[model samples]
Target chain A: MTSLLYKDWSIIKKTRALYFSVLYFSLIMPSFQNMDFFGKSFLANSYYIFIIYLLFSYLTAYDYKYNSDNFIPAFPVTKKQIVAARYVFVALTFAACLVLQSVVRIVILVLKGQDINIMNIMDYGQAAILILVFSLYFGIVLPLYYKLGYQKLRLLMIGAAVISGTVSSVLSEVGLDMNRPLVMLFAVIISAVIYYFSFTISVNIYKNGN
Target chain B: MNKVLEVIGLEKHYDNFTLDKVSFSIEPGYIMGYIGPNGAGKTTTINAILDIIKPDKGKIMLFGKELNGNACEIKQRIGFIIGENAFYEFMNAKEMAGIISRFYKRWDWGLFNKYMREFELDPGKKIESYSRGMKVKFALACALSHHAELFILDEPTSGLDPVFRSELMEIFQQIISDGEKTILFSTHITSDLDNIADYITFIYQGRIVFSRDKDSIMTEFALVKGRKDQRDMVLGSGKIKGMLESDVGFSALTDDRNWFFRNAPGSLVIERATLEDIMVHFVRGNKKYDKLAI
Candidate 1:
């Protein structure tokens, strides 16, 4: 499993320049417009989610392009371990994106001569929402990729993105008070459950799949 | 004989194809040549053995242990090359080897470097720049570096040149020369096995035609060619397994060379069957005698 992580990181390392460029645009582009902190925060968070999604796509694309899906099984690793490594990868990427986004937020505030309270509760709430959205998106898509290879699941990925976007947008419009700590905690709990089940389903799909 | 690998009643089903209850075993210290034409479940069988594809119904025993739930442990003792689909294209050979080496507990870095130098593979070059032959060589380096007891290679010689192919055949000979390591080499190029393979397991359309000692198969099967008018005489001998007809003459495969010599027309020419002759006849020719047909 650690080897799989190292292999994936090696793949990501090759495309570091592209990923950094995406991160730059995702962070800086939202700050150019005249908007309140909440509005700017929302745009920056959305872009962060976009960047993570792009990274996920690149990871899966590399697997397909290099045919690692067929070869990795030959290694001394079980399908369950392979699937678990992917879940761990996503979790790590999510944590890294959050940290990067926080850094960018602080930089933006400092440039604007605004006060920086990096531990804003509302920011945590928003991050939790992003986590829920991403967890659900990956939760559905990873299993599909295992059951039907990347080529066959391309349309399904697009459909999943659309559905995730629509559902998250609707939840936001409903004016749910994500600022509440209890709400954030509930979201975290739900995402964790969803992620756990997703891992189980992905393992089964990969084990039984061709 | 100690069986290094044994597969029984392996089955896999797709919408268009199904790998029936195929069975075979390879003894230690020998090369088992797995021969089949294109789309003949050769890859499927190999996949099942590696547990890359889940079998519907089967039992795979590798090195005297069941290869089901203990895949990670069993896989460590086995090395495999699945065609040209085994490397990360963007990483250099050295980096790829590093990642693969971490998965095996007994990875031998010295052996890996030896193969790298021997195969003329540059460790710094990325795999995307490699030609097909280079990629295969890289895979071989990784497989052999782990000190695996059993090697399952799927068309390891497909894209290689003649010189390298023969060199690889020699390498296989050297691997099993220790009388401990074994190989299950799957290929459509029958000539690759003619000189080295100790056992031959032939599959056609998802079924095993035969699995036996290579020398036994060679001696038991014979190719007979005769004039078109003498087809009846050859067919009446009750020795024809498969037959093919052409403009000038008809050729047939028979299990018994003595039967062909005794009952065949005077114009008929009987010769020993090579692995290629047996595979081509069984796959392309019409089956006239199901009694002898595997």
Candidate 2:
């Protein structure tokens, strides 16, 4: 499993996109003084974007680059081990982003002479939860890629994200409670459902004949 | 002898292509050559055998057991080298080895190092920096390191130079020399099979054309050259599978080389067919067969 994680890390590190995306979000966006938090919270929340788009792109690209299906299927390790390693890879990247985000947050606060309080940590924690929640999107959507192939699934996911976002906007316009506690609770429920479904789908995907 | 790998009636269907009931077996002590042209279902057959894709029909037996239920156990003894180099370009050979070693129960550090040394592969160099030959070498080293009972190689010689190709063949020969190991090597290069394969299986259009002993295949077909009229007469005899007609004359493949030599010594020139010749004949024949049906 350690080997698998190392393999995943090594693969993702090679891609310039991963580094640039993570660095831009985790370290760059958070430091911008004039950044409108309400207007660009999604962008400012680099941790969330890193987990969703970057990490998803990384894992998806990893399969194509390394022929993960060809190599991993041949190994003695079980499908469970392979799926576990994938999660670990995503988790490790999230952890790295957290550290980078914290350092950037501290540096930005020091430069501005602002009090870096527990509230800041809490904000970071919220971002971390959001990242985890978004990873649920990856877990649920990625397994479909095995069946549909990457190009098709990619377009499908893009369409799904757009449609879902549009629906969410319409719901919010109708006064759906998207306040902090409600959003957090919804995210938790969605994450749990996604996790359970992802695990099941991953197994089915592994067993699927290409 | 225990069968190390057995593929029976494995079938996969797509709108554009279908792998038609392909079957073959590798025993514990011999090498099987899986030979075909591009788009001939070599990789698909292998994918099915490995259960990377589920076959619509049939079964794959590995290590004397069914592959699905016994996948982990079977995989433990199987080392596969895919046709393509799919390693992380940034990771050096050492890191790649380090990562792969964790998954195998019988991973051998000393053997891995020995293979690296033998192949002159510098494990410290990143895969992106390595030449194609070096990448193949590194992949080979990884395939051989663990205590594998079976080695499945997909187009292992595609980019290799002649010298390295020979060296790789020697390693494969050495691997199976112990008599406990088996190999199923897929390649478009027939000469490699001529030198290494104990048995040969030819595939065309996602179907097995033939699977037989290398010796038998070699002995079966004779490349016969002759006048167009003479070849026509021979063709009329109904044993010819490969026939090429030209302005000057005709050359064809005959099942009985000795008979052609004996019966048409002055009419046709009989030549021994090498594996390459056999491959050319089959590939051409299959194409001609398709065209005629259309």
In model 2, the runs with Cα more than 4 Å from the true position are A13-47, A78-84, A91-136, A143-190, B261-266, B286-294
Over B1-294, each residue of candidate 1 has an lDDT whose tens digit, in order, gives 678899989989999889999999988898999999989999999988988888999899998888998899999999889957658878888988989999999999999999999989999998878888888888889999998999999999897788889989988898899999999989999999998999999999999988999998887789999898887777777777888889999888998888767766677889989999888888778655444443
TM-score of 1: 0.92
User: Interface RMSD (C-alpha) of each candidate?
Assistant: 1.1, 2.2
TM-score of chain B of each: 0.96, 0.94
Predictions in order: lDDT: 0.82, 0.72
Q: Which ten contiguous residues of candidate 2 chain A have the minimum total lDDT?
A: A164-173
- The positional error of residue B61 in candidate 1, measured at the CA in angstroms, is 0.8
- The lDDT leader among the candidates is 1
The docking category that best describes candidate 1 is medium
Summarize candidate 2's per-residue lDDT along B5-93 as a digit string, tens digits.
87889889989999989988777889999998889999988876665667888899987789878887888787888856746656788
Total clashes in model 1, counting residue pairs 3 or more apart in sequence or in different chains: 0
All candidates: TM-score: 0.92, 0.82
Output the lDDT of residue B173, model 2: 92
